[model samples]
Target: LIISSDSRIPSCGNSTLTGLDGDFVRRSKWTQLIPNTTEATAAAEAAGSSRAAGFMRLTSHRVTIQGANSATLQVNSGQMKMGMTYGFHLQVFNIYRGSNVGNSKETFLVSVKTEPVIAQIRGGDDRLLPIGSLTESKILIDASLSTDPANSTAKLNYNWLLSLSSGPTINTSSLQSLATEQMFFTTVPFLYLNKSSLISDSVYHLFLNVTSRRRGGKAVSSTSQVLRTTSTAVPVVSVLGGGIVNEAIPITLTLSTSSPSPTATYLWECTSQNLILTDPTTRSTSLDSQNLQILPSVLNGGATYTFQASVTIGGATGSASTTVIVNAGPVSGSCGGSPEVGEGLKTYFLLGCTGWSDQDTPMLFKFSTFSPTSTLELSSYSQLSSITTLLPARPSNTTIISSIQDSLGATSSFMFSLQVSQPDTFDVQDTRDLIKIRLTEGDSSLASVLISGTASYVFSNRSIQNTSQQASTVSGLVSLVDSLLNSSVSTTEAQVSTPLSLLQTVTSGPVSSLTTSTQGAVLSIVERTINSSLNSFSNAVASSTLGVLGNVL
Candidate 1:
């Protein structure tokens, strides 16, 4: 006997058998039992060939199972035998006649059941993503995905999202997607956000969704923990009231910023004429509470000072500076001479005195003289303040006074005295040489009587030669000689001979018998000698000579 069954039905179902007993008898079977040995042998051979082909098909193709959580299916390239002890009955048949009977016989018959093959899906493990600080408008989101060893053939797809607020809602308006090769399992996407579009002093959240999928398999998604974004603005610094300031005057300057960061810090600095101001409190150049006070001494008259302000916010810094100009006021100081000076000597009063503005101007001087009564005007065309002049020759002790005036109308006075002294001797030698006199007398013997003597004379008589108390009294002696000659010539001789002999000797004829010509000539000579002696005295004391000489005569 021979049995035949559908191979397709057994391949799609479970092929498990227990034993051949009453269970076999109760089970239904679709079989064609043949009585002819030749037909049975042919049917068994065909069934054996069909089963071989089905096994070959299972070995050549790969199988995939799709589900959220499913295991993988793999088939080996080899035949598997099915055995049963009681579930099915097998019949042996001889497909060939005579000698090849057992070689071509079909003997084995088995029932088996199988389930569908499944390909497992694995989503990578959950993780906390690392995020970098956002200093610019754009930032990079770099993340990686991994799977278990069982899902080695799975691929990962990443999607990055951002949310301004802490919630499930993500802003997709500016969402960006990244593409990579088929072998790549990591994504590095860039997220761009304008500073003007983001709220100030606010926190933001970032989410990373990773989906893993295999070929012909359903996708499984996994999300990362929230990541924070750090964004901050740079500080801007400005300086107020930075300009030109005068010396010794206090100037205030302020530094300000436009940053709202509580951690922001400010620094103020000042520089002038290549000098840096370090201590803002104790020094003339200093800063306090963002306010810089530049004292007058720091400005130093006419110098430029630079003020700088710097602000830092969240590790970002900015700075600004301004310049100040300082101007100075006018300043005032004097020049003079000693109390006594020599006559005919030059005296100088320093007009080059200080006490003027910083600007240059001319100086003027006025001089007054007591003796010879004169006034003089002197000027220094430039800033020089010294003046020089000659003290005039004065007959007596004289006083010279001068005053200096600046362009600013400031005045100062100076005075000095000039003294005149007489010579040691009242010498009339030069005056005597300047005068010549000739007397004419009768040719009898008066020529001998007309004695000629040198006009140069030293009147040693103390009575007429008093220099301290009075000048010489030679003029009064001349008048006395003339009076005596008119009244009594002999009496004139007696008074004249005493002082005259000390000056010059005059031998003449008898006074009563002397010719008119001889008398006139003698008298004229005597008068001229006295006049010349008195004129030799210093003019400083000469004015008192007439009175003294009158008392002596």
Candidate 2:
């Protein structure tokens, strides 16, 4: 780290510190007095073989003066914990030639005790921790090692005894002094709790000031601010139930906070080993249909499940989370429908009720007959419970017959479609087509009519196939009697040549293209032909009201 000053203090080279536990100290963001020193850069350089440079960079503010030249460094309460006991420690090392002209011997003073609450909020210079009895050189101490001035009747003070006998006695007092007259290499020790104290998680604002005690009894202060860690709010999440597979249960989460007014929302995270939603971006806490629609077919087996819920309130966010074991239940599927016929198959349908009982949630039903070759399977559409099946894929000889009963005592019949394929039906070079249909309603008395001729085909991907092969139905039905009646009104059936020719003339021309002359002539001929045909036909069926009506009219 590097220490710089716009004042008379000359810019000293750099220094670094190693073996310092940063995380255990505080979570507050720190700034370097010298712009070149950053946490990462300082840590890397400090870890090197040389220790002198690292120490100098860490302690930016240092003073070098004549015998009576002394300075004091004030670490305010804002740069530290307000109520908790802290140790403001500093390291003195890596001394260099001083540019200032002063006594070969330099004495420095640092407040080892706390002073009065000088500012509205208690300040730092008042809470300095004394080093090695205040008269020793290069001493280390915790916050509690020295008395706090903010709460003490004694004024905060410390004196550094430097021996200029050697080339230059390391100026340790510069580590805590505010005056930057001379460059001194030192390491500013980070303040930490002698004993941990509870601090609510919140934002705390503060700054740092540097001052020096001189032989003349005068003091000087610096102009730099620092923010401290008043408290830290960690995110927490809570999940209500020990998550059970395929089980529908209520889940709730709660989060705790340090700051009273935290603005936040909940996030649910399912960290199951199973193939749950793997996309993190798409996963969220909302219980909307798109996010919560878990199909009955997905649950498989036992797996570890965990969910994390997070909320951000008033710029402070907290998350709560929990983990549980998810045990899967038995799988089920639909068997058959309608008569639900076969050697052994059955089917059921939804009863359509407003509510269901807890017991009914996982319903159980028995089959009328057991199939040695086939198994019972639940159909999702029927909404039946406890359906079982032996096959993982579609069975070759699958069939089912079943009945459903509603809450109102109404019974309905249903059928399950048999599998379309047979085990030995096809080979590599041969092809066989099969049609399957599941009939939910059937009238046994009705004859089986083959409506396969009405089937339609759809072409896709250069392949032509019957899309609705099972439902070969026709659009409309015409009765035999109605068919005969329409045939008699046709122009092709006219008996007389003139009538036939006139009929052609009337029907040959488009309705919009026909002239008045053509229309009138055709009408006259049609009237004569109709009168003659009516008389003859009526005579053949004398009891019918045909000839008598025309004659009377």
lDDT of 1 at 98: 32
What is the per-residue lDDT of model 1 for residues 158-276, given as tens digits with 9 covering 90 to 100?
55555556433434443222212211243422233443344444345555555554333544454433333323334545566644344545677777765545676777665343545
The local distance difference test score of model 2 is: 0.27
Instruction: Report, for every candidate in turn, its global Cα lDDT versus the true structure.
Output: 0.36, 0.27
Most accurate candidate by lDDT: 1
| Clash count, predicted structure 2 | 70
Candidate 1 deviant stretches above 4 angstroms? 1-232, 260-262, 271-273, 280-288, 331-355, 359-553
State the TM-score for model 1.
Answer: 0.21
RMSD after CA superposition, every candidate: 61.7, 40.1
Output the worst ten-in-a-row residue range by lDDT, candidate 2: 444-453
